[model samples]
Target: MAVEVKYVVVRNGEEKMTFATKKEADAYDKMLDLADSLGEWLQQAPLNLDDEQREGLSFFLAEHKDALGQILRGAAPAEAPKKAAKVKMEKSVATSKEGSTSEKQAA
Candidate 1:
């Protein structure tokens, strides 16, 4: 029912990465993309790195995400966003709270 990938960070030997399913893979990929963009954006405006260097860094990260993480990072490959079990519990709690609030307001 779920696809999972276990990855170890090369630089930080102790860091472990795991994704529950294809959706999780996709969410991670998007996260990587945003991080990459933010790095570039920072360099261009406030950071002011040269354009050539910026392009090179983007290319490098795009090419190397798999080595950085557990699997080859690409587009959102999963149909749904993979969420941690803890997040699911949090969502349930929030929903219950909202329901209770609604009942109180109705009363």
Candidate 2:
């Protein structure tokens, strides 16, 4: 006989998820909390939203909290870092040149 430990997240008297570790359960619970708060806030928006739409928008924002946080903090969306962009561009040029030479050889 073996005993297993599990963490379960329950919401409104229903079990939402089960996790092997408490950390994962806590993270999921936190996201749900954020979604709940966002849903309430959306109710105050001028645009009319049906209940389903508000719920969906709330979850979407909660799932992308990192990007939303940056925007809310007055930061513009970040572009790819210059060094990485340069490396990607170099790789693309090298590949295109290699393809042209290969085509010439085949011709």
Among all candidates shown, the one with the greatest TM-score: 2
Report the lDDT tens digits of candidate 2 across residue range 41-78: 99999989999999999999998897787678666446
Candidate 2 RMSD computed on C-alpha atoms after optimal superposition onto the true structure: 9.3
Off by over 4 Å in 2: 74-107
lDDT of 1 by residue, 1-107 (tens): 98656543222354324565667656656655655685666575655577777766665666555444433343243412353456788999999999999999999
List the lowest-lDDT window of 10 residues for candidate 1. 7-16
Candidate 2 lDDT score at position 91: 100
Whole-model lDDT values for every prediction:
0.60, 0.91
